[model samples]
Target: MTSTLTRLPRPYQSYVYAYPHKTAYRPLAPRPTLHEVWAGEPRDPLSLYLHIPFCEIRCGFCNLFTRVGAPGDLTTRYLDALTRQAETVRACLGTEHSPRFANAAFGGGTPTFLEAGELIRLCDIAERVMGADLDAIGFSVETSPATATTDRLAVLAGRGATRISLGVQSFDENESRAAVRPQRRADVETALARIRDTAVDVLNIDLIYGIDGQTPASWRYSLDAALAWQPEEIYLYPLYVRPLTGLSRRDRAAADLAWDEQRLRLYREGRDHLLTQGYEQQSMRMFRRIDAPAPGPDDYSCQTDGMIGLGCGARSYTRNLHYSFDYAVSAQEVRAIIDSYTATTDFDRAVVGRAIDADEARRRHLLQSILQADGLPVADYRARFGTEPHTDFPVELARLAERGWLADTGPARLRLSPEGLAYSDAIGPEFFSTAVRAAMAEYELR
Candidate 1:
């Protein structure tokens, strides 16, 4: 049986992180209040995410929910809206059921795009408005080399930011140009120096593989350059050209079998190289230094815990629903959503999301947990759902086993083999319910 399963074809899907794309989200009529959404849910340690959807420039291959540049007063208005939303959400959570946030992150087009003063105010919203202690919990922020200046880093560091993730897509100028991410190596080095000068405990540098004209040698060059910083974490991403992105118009040939083979090879090379450098693989994209301080609370688990997302681009998740403001890729639509988000006075519960039934919840639990280096624990699954994973996903489990992807199918646990982990992208989408696929397909691409 292990020899007979059909292997997926080339351009193998890479589900690097989270699943069920926001594209699948639909409008929720008569949106429920946040109080109603959290009524019976456990007030466990929650994760907080704030989205800053403005960037100095948009990369070609980028499809994230962010716009390029902020027009006059747009940043200020957006921040005001964020504060209002936070206050509203805080009120919704109420005093008694308010959750204790164990982890927090500021991500987006670029959180550092704001001025130093704006960054300080951003921290105030999290601390004073949302009631999160930045100094007590792990606080991470995403930045671009161009925006990560000394003053900005100092502000973040002063506010108790433990980790600073810089997007240094590549060290080679030509590759950066090829990815439509213009940046000089000098800028990255300068940013790294500034970040270090702030004494931030953890520095994460992000790199990309499989860019056009990026050869094995060039990949190694970028890898070696990133390792030179001895970053607490390094993320190697395989570039994907999505619709409406700047790179989408370039060429479709870049997504073929040969390209995938090159990407796979580069991924393996980076992984093996980092392992040799004494880094541990956290996921297909993340590698953590052995001695670095843990990035998040040990007790917080995204699989089961609730998340509070603040911003037009952020998505909040409860036990059964994941909701956010409208998602868009095009410049016009993003601007419109941001304008609406800023002008609105109502910050209620979910207004756009798909309801997660029991089966979907089980699938979400499995997909989120199993993709990690440590496979899912069967006992925990059974305890949570009162049934075995095999009982709910027998066919999928059998197919994985038939493909030699199951490492162990013990009574106590169901672990994926390393080879299985490599194919995580292919496995994750297989669990998407038929309803989700239909909804996503029907959703208009904004």
Candidate 2:
């Protein structure tokens, strides 16, 4: 277990988008069948995700499992494999489970990286093959400026995509070069215009801070540029230069106190600017326009429910186990993983995954809820877990209070203080179980 934090950890620790982090996952012994995995899981509704591991360009700071290009029959073969995986997954979920898909998302290197016709085929696999109703669900897609073509957006809009998230890391050309995300301001604007022509209910723009050569003035320039379009949502990500990424080969993003304080300053700047622009801060990375359209019925609550992911890089989560294919960051290793996935015929069992136990569940609930701006409802936590959060992890909670990271909102809630949310990256890892931390450390050494 990590020692009590009497002092502050680096502000830019690891991002906690998922619990147990995928790094903790290992090759399951005697792998559990999908049918068994879903046997007693909730059947009310689930989130659907289809991952495309192809991108036009690889960003320097990205460690996501994706390749730069899909040439010749690569896309076709990948889609065919996805179709097979979806059928197998649906058959395993079966009528006995009575699964209902409430919402869906197409994520990836770039889902829009496919051609216009390919996008249509991808939609067919989701609806016709997987039994999901895109037309009636809160469907979202991730895209990039180079691939957000008119025809592609038209197909997505026609297929009932409710939201589109475009990754425009930086509008400043120099900053982009520094991050190794090549693009021009003109291209980003053009893509935004094409998306506006569509009927998608929400549009999200992603920007990055802490890039080399990025100044407070330059960061504000990028923020003001994104604000001009009145996007429904904006995400300001702190740049991370992890091993196996392009930037890691360089000397940028030194993980010292200087880098941490610099990023903290930039985050405050971006957060304050968004609040003044009438945007509501949802989390450390997400800010939504105050008037942004509300989500539709059957929205997926990932914190509690299950998710079905049908891609090499995508991970599926049951209440206890989270599983997926092998993860790789380098181009060669990623290509090898994708090749294995495309050639695979048996998609019935979970080969690689981590099993979440009872104790971790409480920690996950608290960490996920506390990281958000709204905080966690203590009553709900007690009702569900049948115990108080403070009872489960007294040392962790007390340390937070001691650091002035935990807020006092009376006994009804367990929420992070404003200062706590600012250091969410540090706080999230404090909850990582000893088992998970060891596994992650072992993976890094390998």
Candidate 3:
């Protein structure tokens, strides 16, 4: 069946109504037990994702599971549980297997927003559970530009953080004020200079292209400032106005907001500019130094099967199952994440049935696989699944090819064209849509 969406911007119009946004959800196909896949198995590599949900303040555009002024004692309570959770995660490893860690990311409303003591304690928990060979691990932490302080950077280095992804949405004063993100350009530069001199191996700046009261000029300026810092990595994201947030509050009247055409153009410019500066396009949003290279495709998060999540709203994908816990929110929001994660089960099956569905698994592979520095290996897929992408996704691949959105450069190699990368969210329907995925898709497109 041939169909197209009729919006405008020609390419977008073709995707206007091709298919209903929602795709059928296929529950996870049966897989081996967690013990078998992760315990002592020689499966995929491993990483750790720790979530810290407290922030000194909130951003207008942020919808992450975080809160400001969450009880003064919140950090203490969270660290206690975090320690226990780390132990629980460590217990999952078989006695015979060696601890293998490729990366560890401390992400949140602002992980640096935590008190120095709490930050130190949490890092202790990581070292205790995973050990101190972190010198070999690609450890990363996220922070808002405003919160980047000398003390905070010092704490991160103490905890073995090798990279910092600072959030600097825009350089324009008006745009920063509109988004309620208060950080001067000078502050970010000073902070970066200090961080660069630290033990941290990589410096990553996160820039948002589309936002209320932001224009191409503003975005270009932000890009220029980020480039001036000469970070080892740069992540470019477009502004997304999600429902029920401060962003949605002013999204309607924001003429500076770059939607379809403008958003696309801004992204292209970022790519062109970064490429000119000797940064290779590692993925849609990420650019890295040519010689040093990134670990894999999904550098933001680990692509491996064993990711241990700590803190409220943290998500862990073990070999066979997934588990998550959130810090105490109002009775309402807690129930929401819990409900969504534990949907399939009556009481907590949704969360308990955490194994990823085949479709989602497939989609994850596509996104992360293409982004791989080593590139996707066709033989590797066949060895694992006993089938090829062409055999498994014949229809989907055919559709994408028909639209000239993708090209099969080799048996296992597929690349998204500029148009496809710009509209990459369309690839998600082939899998499931949790509230998070829906939110991510809507935000990425916006």
Candidate 4:
């Protein structure tokens, strides 16, 4: 169905963080038990993800499943619900055939939004109930400048968080405000100092390009500011104003082509700047220092293994399906889902998600690999799927090659050129399955 003599489409359609977005999911008919859903899947150590939905403020360009604030003991109630869900999930996985976890992560509006004591309790649930050794597993946590408190970070370090990602969209105060993320440069520096005081081994700084008033010079200032910390990893994200986000209310990008061109220019600038500073491109968004800390015992790859997610906003992925509770961006729907999750006691069923069939699996493998800097290994793909990627998706490959997106580095691997990686946000959607496209199209926004 994907056939056309190719011409380049607009780059930056969307960020393909995961194949088949959450919007593609639906309520499961004859809801399957967690056991049935995971049965026959590889019991190899899986990645554990815990989602916390509260944040001090939502970024203007963010469409994540998180809410603005937690009122009157709501966080405590949420953690209680998390504990209950963990207990149930642990019981379902059972003693005889339970899946072992290799690593863990805490993500959301901001996980460090919890107080030091509350953070300890959250760690306890992960360690005691979920059977994940945080110290040994090298867990990661996400935080914002406003919430990266010394007490909370100390607790995280003491409990074994190896990595902490601080979302400081821009060090330029004006650019920060333009992005609807209110914070002073002084506050951001203070937060960075607090994070460095902790024992965390790897620090990832998140920055964005394409803010409303961002210029090349202003963009370089933020990049240089982030480098001042010499973080282990850095992510330069292009600003995408998704539906229902604060930026989406107004027409921020009246001229789509101009916006895309601006983003591309900034992206190339950021990529080149990092490279010169001894960082290696891990993907379109991620760059790692050449001397970054070596992998620990808990090194887990998201491409191959399954993920067991806790909290209302998280999703659990098995080889056969990806399941999660209802997803939302609007504050009202998000609060409603969290309320329902906290009140519910039955946690054994796979209520809503999409089933991944054979074809979808191949596409996922292809998408995940090709988007990275290393690109896809042809031998690996053939061995895994018993078919060459080119043979299976001739039209897709043709379209990509026609655009000069594919490099002539040889047939040993299916790799995207530098320009291809630049166009990743566009290239990713080119491989989405027709069924998934339909499902996403039909999903109604709240």
What TM-score, computed on C-alpha atoms, does each candidate reach? 0.96, 0.97, 0.79, 0.97
Q: Candidate 4, which segments miss by more than 4 Å at Cα?
A: 1-7, 253-255, 297-299
Worst 10 residues of 2 by lDDT: 1-10
In the range 293-375, model 4's lDDT, one tens digit per residue, is 96466445666689999999999988889999999889899999999998988899988999988899999999999899889
Instruction: Assess the local accuracy of residue 212 in candidate 2 as a C-alpha lDDT between 0 and 100.
Output: 87
Summing lDDT over every window of 10 consecutive residues in candidate 4, give the lowest-scoring window.
1-10
lDDT per residue (tens digit) for residues 1-446 in model 1: 32112346343564536656787788998788888887788766988999999999999989888998998999999999999899889888888876788989999989999999999999999999988899999599999999998888889999999999999999999999999999999989999888888888999999999899999899999999999989999998888888889999986774377677777788888889999998998876789999998776789887788899999998888888888888889989988998899898888767887677798889888988878877788888888999988889999989889988788657777777766766777787788888877887887886
Model 2 steric clash total: 0
Report the C-alpha lDDT of model 2 over 1-446, residue by residue, as the tens digit.
54223257788889999898988899999899999998889977888899999999999999888999997899999998999999999888878666788998999989999999999999999999888889988698999999999999999999999999999989999999999988999999999999999968999999999898899999999999999989999998998889889899986545466777778899999999999999998999999999999866745666788899999999998889999989888898999998998898889999899888898888888888889988888887887889998898899889999989877898888888877888999989999999989999889521
**Better structure of 1 and 3 per lDDT:** 1
**Candidate 1's error at 292, in angstroms?**
1.5
Q: Where is the poorest 10-residue window by lDDT in model 1?
A: 2-11
For residue 424, model 3's alpha carbon misses the true position, in angstroms, by 1.7
Query: Lowest lDDT 10-mer window, candidate 3?
Result: 16-25
What lDDT score belongs to each candidate, Candidate 1 first? 0.86, 0.89, 0.61, 0.89
Clashing pairs in 4: none
The positional error of residue 305 in candidate 4, measured at the CA in angstroms, is 1.2
lDDT of 1: 0.86
